[model samples]
Target: MRIIVYGSLRREQGNSHWMTNGQWLGDHVIDGYELYSLGHYPGVIKGMGKVYCEVYRIDATMLAELDALRSKGGEYKRELTSTPYGSAWLYVYQHSMAGRKRIVSGDWLQRDKES
Candidate 1:
C-alpha cells in the first residue's frame, strides 16, 4: 500500500525509522489540505490549501504501526487521499486546532525556515 506523510515521518525527520521498510516513491503536493504545527510534529486537515508530502510504498505491518501511532489520543485518523503516485493513506487531524500554529507553506521543513 502507499502512504502520504507530511510531517516527522518524512525523510530525515523524527519517527522516520518507522519507514525503514518502506520504499520512498517521491515528493508530492497534495491539494485541499492545511498543515498545522503540533510541537514536535505536524498535522494536516482538509482545507483549501496545499501540502507538500512524501509518498512511500509500505507493507501492511508498517501501515498498522503507523495507524496506531497517529491514532493515539485520537489526534489523527487515516484517510484515503489522492496523490500523484496513487490513492494513499493520509493522517488527517482529528482534534481542534484552536491555538495550533498553521504552517502556511504546508511544508514542515519550510516551517522552520519561516520562523
Candidate 2:
C-alpha cells in the first residue's frame, strides 16, 4: 500500500522510524488542501493551497503499525485519497484548526524554521 505523509512521518522527521521498511517514493503535492501548524506536527484541512507530502510504499505490517501510531488518540483519521502517484492513505486531522496557524507554504519542512 502507498501512504502520503506530510508531517513528522516524512523522512528525517521524529516518527519516520516507523517507515524504515518502506520504499521512499519521493515528494508529491496534493491539491485542494492546506497544511496547518498543530504545535509539534502539522495538520491538513480542506482549503485552497497545495499540501506537500512524501509518498511511500509499505507492506501490511508497516501499514498496521502506521495505523496504530496515527489512530491512537483520534487526532488523525486515515482516508483513501488521490495523489499524483495514485490512491494512497492520508492522515487527515480530526480536531478543529480553530486557532492554529496555517502553513501558507503548504510544506511541513519549510514550516519548521518558522516554529
Candidate 3:
C-alpha cells in the first residue's frame, strides 16, 4: 500500500523512516495542515487548507501499523484520500494548539544541516 505523509515525519534521507518501519514515499511540501507547536513537539490540523505530502511506497503491513498509530493520537490521522499513486491513505497533521506556522525543513534526501 502507498501512503502520503506530511509533517515532521518527513525523513531527510528517505520518504519514510526506518524508525516508523514505513517505506519512504517521496518529498513534498503541502499547506493547509494546521500547525500547533507543543514545546519541542508539534501537531498539524488536516483538512484545514491544501496540505501536500511527501509520499512513500511501503508495504501494506507497515501502512496498517502507521495507520493505527496515527489514529491513536489527536495530532495525527489517516484519511482516505486520492493521490497520483491511486486510492491510498494519507496522514495529515492535526493542530493540537493554535499558531500560524511554516515547516522549516523535512526529509528530502538533501541532508539535514546537522551533518
* Predicted candidate 1 versus true structure: per-residue lDDT over 1-115, tens digit per residue: 9999999999999888989899999999999999999999999988989999999999999999998898989989989988778889999999888999999999998988776
What lDDT is reached at residue 64 by model 2? 90
Report how far off residue 6 is in candidate 2 (Å).
0.4
Instruction: Write the candidate numbers in order of decreasing lDDT.
Output: 1, 2, 3
Model 3, 90: alpha-carbon shift in Å? Answer: 2.1
Model 1 score (lDDT): 0.92
Worst 10 residues of 2 by lDDT: 106-115
Candidate 2 vs 3: which has more TM-score: 2
For all predictions, the C-alpha RMSD in Å is 0.9, 1.5, 5.2
Candidate 1 least-lDDT 10 residues: 106-115
Candidate 2 lDDT over 1-115, as tens digits, reads 8999999888999888888899998789999888999888888978899988999988999989988887889988888887667789998888899999999989998995665
Model 1 misplacement above 4 A: none
Better of 1 and 3 by lDDT: 1
Best by lDDT: 1
**TM-score on alpha carbons, each prediction:** 0.96, 0.91, 0.55
- What overall lDDT, based on C-alpha atoms, would model 2 receive against the true structure? 0.88
For all candidates in order, the CA lDDT equals 0.92, 0.88, 0.53
